[model samples]
Target: MHGLVLAALAVLVSLTAAASLNAATIGKANSTNCVMLIGGEIVQGDFEKFVTIGKLLLPGDDGESTRRNTVCLASSGGSLSEGVKFAKYFYDNGIGTVIDDGQECYSACAIMFMMGTATGAEVSFANRKLHVGGKLGFHRPYLRISPGESIDSSAMQIAYDAAFSSALDLIAVANSKSPWSSQPMMKSDLVQRMLQHVGNDMFMIDTVDKVGRWDIEVFGSSEPSLLSEEQAFYACENSLQWQNGLTKGDITYSNVSDGPNGKRRSQSLSKETRQAVYQVEGLASGYAMESCVISRKKGTIFGCGIDEYSDARLGQGDCDHSNFADRSSSLKAISVFNPATKLEDLRTGQAVVAVQSGAARCFVIKGSQITDNEPCLVIHVGDAKVRGRASTITHFVWPSGSKTVLVQSGTSFEINGVSTGKRTVAERGDCYLNSATLNDFCVLTSPN
Candidate 1:
């Protein structure tokens, strides 16, 4: 299993040959009008490279037509910061950038799709791997089934049809010009088109979270949530419309919300489950060896190493040794993000990396990528629990013999009286402390 996981990690977050174009020499403007900036090298000052490309693509002479033909970008996302700058530059300037060639753009390059165009200009994607991910843990809602668990025929039929059509429509829309207008597409056709046209260029929507267009706005989030119904459906295994309207295998936000039976009180995962999610996926190292791979600075929480921190101390660097924190739905299937939040800002449910331990310890921004050497996120999808028909996790912790707790941070817990400092109960995975628990609070547990 370890080997298999490592192998999978290798394939998912590959370290591409780093390359970038020489800075635009500062003074030479190309007459070709539209500049083709091929990120041939792994970009160090990635955004600057895109800015160079942007220079040639200003608004037209009349401020209407594109000043330059267009900027053609080719390369994987080496620097998310740089990629965002490039994308924003194009969007702000009202010019469309193209991802072309056999180049695979991952990471921040996925933002290439975030252009706010009125006409919904043709965002062509071909033979590119837009694998976007970040280090962010996820919260899988509690799920369970009783002895006579079953679905009603009529309800089940409605669910099945909704699911089938939703799947078809989603595929058609993603692949077709306007998915809504294309009606529905066959599963095979959708996959074929995605593989053919998108190749590895665009994101390969895998987990149920990403099935929905809205669930996942960015790659890394605290709790990887299904932004949309599509994401929720596909995320479940053999999804079924239970008698309660909740999919059998799917976990809902309500399950993680404040309730008698939900994850609002504590870390829903058990020790084994936590360990399972945190299992090392792979190992990566840089050839740059002049400086020790591990470096410790005063006031930092942990020693910094190239494995998780950038060898080149260009800016603040990706990983902050003083603080190490990460959250990933890929490893744990928990993506928690808000659409309004910028990639620069971190929000709840998003896994974080920060100073291991220190008064000033804080979660900082570390580019999201499993193979990038930085600490990667391991998603843990907790077992499902059902209530009324909708399934949710029952992560309540109670004292020896007591009830009544609080729902804090969206975790469910059982307490005797008013108690503080709660933790995961034990292996069976029930966190009970029997304190004067009122509102369910989210619980923290040891990481794998």
Candidate 2:
């Protein structure tokens, strides 16, 4: 039985090697002019054909290489060595890769997808897109040994070494930093997750969390409904915050606008901030809005939520009779009143704290004494209360702070305020504020 098993493994390895030498088909895809599809088993000649196609499509004439040239991949995986070579070529030449809708890329093919890059001024993983309907899976590289095969110690050791080398090469490729952007082509977490699964099984990039954490773009689908967006946003936001060592919790959206056809939209844009609000059903607050703010310059998204009853004018009495009457709060504690809530309940001398810009600073809110002493480029206060709620005579006061000079120096910012100075280091797509001025500010430009 052992002899038969060994013979079977030998035959399987030979057949696999022979099959992997055949060139994969590479040609213009029907979907787009710039997209070339690489289908079937990847092998020896595929890399040459890919380079040929890439050169023909992206001739170095007058910066033509900067054009969008994508290689959409569809394969069950073949030669790992060839895959590494192709991935290196893609990275060096800024060639994008994609798994189109309904297609699949696994193992070696998936490695190529992850290392793909796009030609642009800044480092962007947007080119390595995996369509919502497509599948991208990974697993540890393995030898082509038959199950239950009885192999000699030397042969087994050789196979194990080969697999180990492949894995190390993969890690090296993933950790390689881009010459221009200094960002890793692929994150370590992604590579670690890929190596967790055995050769016979796969760890699929099936969840939205996986896709976002890996920074893989998704397309071929319209924006989800508010409910779905709310859930997905929370999950993604939690993941991002956890990764960044930031706190995570339930967010609030204080302002909401009802659009045509029962849809609600909230948008606010300035030199410093761009905010979008989506109305969603809330179990605790009855009616809620999921608010997301994007740093115009940094491209980081800060999201929170707001409940209908948060508005002070829509107090306990009024909320009990409104559409969200079922979720009306019975509590009488004033401490539960958030910055956007209990506005009408504020007394003559009550002090309330509200976040000015991205949690950069908090100011004391007292009736008609609103001050704008801060040197912020933009200060957005959610004034629009719950939809169709009755107006109130009480007006909410805004906060005031100090003037500051913001200077960008590499990945860090130096803020010189009137009384004190502080420095903040930021990662790409992260929002930060100055502790000196209590001004919310984020880096909008990429590091040089």
Candidate 3:
């Protein structure tokens, strides 16, 4: 059995060329000491390199008395075969993995990181700590498409699908042994999204939410970086629905209060089954509410729905809803946004002020992308302070989270009781006025 498996692994490894794999001990086990594996574009010989490095760094002769081994990785993924081989080796050695601060482990490297946990090959979570400031990205198994080669054939298509399935399975296995049930391995939807949106470009796990989904224990000083407010706002706006009879822009000053279960709490939700719903009110058209369902594994918004009516409230179906918009039922008005608009075309270094629902937000414009066919952006919300000049002003506030007011461009407002004309800011207060109101209710600030 062992020989057959080795033979199969060898055959897979032979599919690629020579690879670069480097290893060295950086510290001791009690000190969280680890063997650092640095590689570029995994290849065939890489497996052998791990074998030699494993002996030098974590010798088998050490027996049970030896300190638990930890491995740190900085790689951009190479051969899938080599990646699998190395992951199994790490598991067999009961080795832990780390993506140190300021480092990156993308593609196959991320696989190694995922597998170096209690579930894949390691015994427990005693020494494994995925520090912040490092990047871990995933995409589909990369394959070269020869020039002028058509993949239209059914046989070729089958082969391609098989390869993708195998790749996803490998990733799933890596994440299967998470220490926390709240954080499990990769999910099918997440893998599909990677294949769709990420493509050749890396889908970086930049947020704490994203990292937490993978169940990789984080150890760092930085808070989870806030993603583009524009994207969040867009999600909130498009997700709204007038369920028992509500129209868009018919009213303002809505209040979205998440229920007791919706409020942020100490207990973490299961990555697979986690959900929350907001109870909306204060609208001219009676009561309205929106619910956002997220995939904890990917830390992404999957499906969102809203109900507008005096009696609109969450049903059992709303809490455990699909990530995609529910448009099948005609009883309620629903708008589903899939593969959100790509924000790559948006110019950076600009500011955009947008209002939706009943809240206002100002974003330091960066760019956007359609993640998993969902629109996404990279932006920063401003505070009430003079920073720089103002630019674009989008009218409308989508009521979801907190309410902030944004003033029109070329408008001045007081900050700390002082008048400022050339700054853009996001003030902490609610500004409610009918559509006829073209007033500057919030101060603006610059990016300086």
Candidate 4:
């Protein structure tokens, strides 16, 4: 019996090698602490090799080792069975995954990418990540047969059954809570869409809606950006909805307080100060009355408020600062809004604000002059004292975390006393500080 099982395994390995002409190359990522599975088709041989190396490189059962070691996937996909095996191994080990910018993970590769998990300090979360420029495509699993190969009805049925069984396994893994994170790997709708595409067709997760719905973390996109009047207003409204824990798709916005067809108001303020009193519906029981005060010159949200009708009223009877400070959803909305104005175009003294919630009346500039006191959180762009040096600085206020400052002039800015050149995009965990003031400038890329 042992000899027969060994023989069966040998035959299976031989068949897999013969079928997978272009096997994936698995090795350490260059200049980084990550494992890269690049090119070709995923096969049993490659999967086994990865497991062997992964076990040695990722030996810590405490989850920290797995979190530090990410498997970056860039493949056109190969064997569905092998892909399933890889996914199971990643989930069991609490390994994180990344589809980096300019990379593509399709078909079986997408399956492996979706199943990546990691354990955080307090809770476990889906560590499956997709860069903004990366492409992740999916299609239904199908049996592959050599050209002109003759097969009986029984053999064909068995092959079909195996393919279907693999699909079912994929669904189960997607829906099942991670042993470490206790979070579903992917959304049900994402799986449904994945299976909808047959054979050569592909369902690409290419939009913000799909990305958000699937619970995939996206990075490397432009940030601390500016938005149009319409997009900014929508973001403000969306932030309110998120703070109240309302479903994003359920809420709808209207420019006018009455309805969609209501008459537009002639502005009492200058063109540089845009004001809008919008109505937000699809809340609990009733709708919300909201107002937006924007600085058109700076392309920032100057002030915003939710009225008495808002469900997010935290005893203050209006836009509560606690709600905005409690959640970082608003910062995410700011970063995701498209057709954003460039940061370089912005002038000095112009404030780039994130999300603001307060009880003060929304500011509306009158006739090119400031009328009301600024009620929102503001980060000015000008000369400031940093570590005993007077430098021209621009600061960004994250939702519930520390600030990120951009030094424009004065002293040479060095992260950890090492000059990182003119353009430096800080990583998530990096921290820069002015010892004189103890101001921590940490780069937190992810909104969560």
Top TM-score: which candidate number? 4
lDDT of 2 by residue, 1-448 (tens): 5654444334221112123444678888766623688888886567888888767665332243433768888887777767888888877677778888678888888888887776655444335877767888887665665568677765565555655666667678877774465557676767777668866478887644455446666665322111223222343233323233222243432222234443322222332222232222332332443222211112222232333333222112222112332322211111111212212222232232332333232221123231221112222222232224321111112211112233333333343422223334343223335454354433322332
- Give one digit per residue, the lDDT tens place, for model 1 in 1-448: 5544433222222112233335322222242322454444333465665466446544433333343434444444433333434544544444444433223434334443333121223432111111233221111111111246454445444444543443343333333222223322113332343334322244343333332232232332233211221122112211111101212332322212233543221111113311211111001222332111111122111111122322322122233322323311121132222112233232234332321211110111122211111112222224343232322222221110111223333344223333344444332122333333233332323322
Model 4 ranges with Cα > 4 A deviation: 1-20, 31-33, 59-65, 120-122, 178-183, 225-233, 236-448
Predicted candidate 4 versus true structure: per-residue lDDT over 11-77, tens digit per residue: 2211111245667888766525345544567876788898777766664446344566588888888
User: Candidate 3: lDDT of 117?
Assistant: 42
Lowest summed lDDT window (length 10), candidate 1: 136-145
| Candidate 3: tens digits of C-alpha lDDT, residues 1-448 | 5544433333231112224343322323333435545545666566786677666766432333223456777676766756777776665555677777656677777666666643223324423556655667776564544456544445445455645665755765655544444444454445554566443576666543334333345554321112222223233333343222223442222122235533321111232222322222222222434443322123334433344433343232244333234521211111211112111211123354431221223321212211111111222344433356563323222112122333333565332233434433334223222233223333122212
Structural similarity to truth (TM-score) of each candidate: 0.23, 0.50, 0.43, 0.56
Considering TM-score, which of the candidate structures 1 and 3 is the better prediction for this target? Answer: 3
Quick one: ranking by lDDT, best first?
4, 2, 3, 1
Question: What are the per-model C-alpha RMSD values against the true structure?
Answer: 23.3, 21.9, 14.2, 14.6
State the lDDT at 302 in candidate 3. 40
Order of candidate numbers by TM-score, starting with the best: 4, 2, 3, 1
After TM-score superposition, what is the CA distance of residue 226 in candidate 1 from its true location, in Å? 35
